[model samples]
Target: MNRLAYQYVVLRCVPRVDREEFLNVGVVVYCQAADYLQVAWQVADDRLRALHPALDVDQVRDALGFIEGVCAGDGRGGAAAGHPVGQRFGFLKAPKSTVIQPGPVHGGVTTDPAAQLQHLLGCLVG
Candidate 1:
């Protein structure tokens, strides 16, 4: 089997309230450096759930694409529901600055998405 390299971005929103609600309003862009066929959405529902307990899994799952595209700077659509209007939430300003250094993939891993994305890119180019 031919191994494929993929880059993914996961975005999320955390309400600064007592409940600590988490809204998954981000996207994951996965693509093979050589071809777009490998392109896919990693989505942020699971990540959001892992990060925050107040989020509804169903709603997060449904909004994965919208979140992913917006966060990835694809200019898809509006902000996540329930968030303040006109609030721009994303990490597209400086993607390279968010890259995480790879240490170990397993054994209580704590790899950040930006770093993972950069690592994937490096694997494709290196």
Candidate 2:
């Protein structure tokens, strides 16, 4: 069976309207497969603030290989050919388009933790 590895960075920033609250900032590296998955994420805080931008892009790409190794359980086997990390990770998804934006939608398949985790893992192992 052929398995694939995917990775992407999620950059979150709190708009000034929120008074610059520390939101989920930085990138997340995730590897998924049919049966196993692993994710490593680093946040940008005071000590690691400066590294945020560069790390966001570079780490995310580097993470594809790292995550593949972790999922392979041997730290080997490079990324598969033609993997769409951004789309798979929702990076390319357009933001919710609505003239009158409603509050955060609570009821949704994406909000399910177990399902989300399972999907993530499946992406790494499959």
Candidate 3:
């Protein structure tokens, strides 16, 4: 079977960087052959509160929205959207100090990019 190239990273919510604690909250997948970059996220408010009771849910949700916007190439995506697919993926995979941060980038070959994205999300974030 023919296969396409794909890369992905898991997003984590780190309420306190000094504490070095985090919860897997989302996944970002990029399929270069398909020219697709999408983020799949399901924020568990309870989980966040469990880690840091004072954590703001709205802020976390908004961060997730920004990630989605970047994937959609919307105006809210800012300069990152104008970049090539690989560059955008690189931006997403970069580390951040905010509550939402990208994990390491993982690569694989898949016959179906969309299906592979869901599979990665289910396995890594869900």
Candidate 4:
């Protein structure tokens, strides 16, 4: 199989942006040729709580769910579904000031985006 170019971003949880502290919470990946755009996330509740004792897991969970919806183009995706794949990816990769933010965009080549996504999740967020 030909190697396909892919891009990914590590999703971070910044409970306090002023302190510039964060925890890796998830990964979003996109491969246009494979038409695969998805997110793999694992919220380490204990780790998160350690970072910010006052952090609410429920709110963080809701934010992760919204990202999943956007990746899947579900109704909860809001206006993301109306855009093309690249646009959707651009939207997700853009920086944000909220609790959830995307890290810098990174690139690689892969034969299987699904497997690559898992690898990234493990290496970057897990």
- Cα lDDT tens digits, model 1, 1-126, are 344454443333442335444343433333334222111233345565566556666654444444444444454534432332222232221232111111111211223434454454344322
Q: What are the per-residue Cα lDDT tens digits for candidate 3 across 1-126?
A: 879988899999999899999999999889988888999988889988999999998999899988887888887788888788778888999989888999888899999887887888788778
RMSD of each: 11.8, 14.7, 1.1, 0.9
lDDT of 2 by residue, 18-103 (tens): 33333333333333443223333343334233433333444433534444443334434243212444333332222422111112
lDDT of each: 0.37, 0.34, 0.88, 0.91
Model number with the top TM-score: 4
Of candidate 3, the 10-residue stretch with the lowest lDDT total is 75-84
Q: Write the per-residue lDDT of candidate 4 for residues 1-126, one digit (tens) a residue.
A: 899999999999999899889999999999999888999999999998888999998899899898888889887788886677788899999989999999999999999999999999998887
TM-score, ranked from best to worst? 4, 3, 1, 2
TM-score of every candidate: 0.28, 0.23, 0.94, 0.96
- lDDT for model 1 comes to 0.37
2 against 4, candidate with superior lDDT: 4
How well does model 2 score by local distance difference test? 0.34
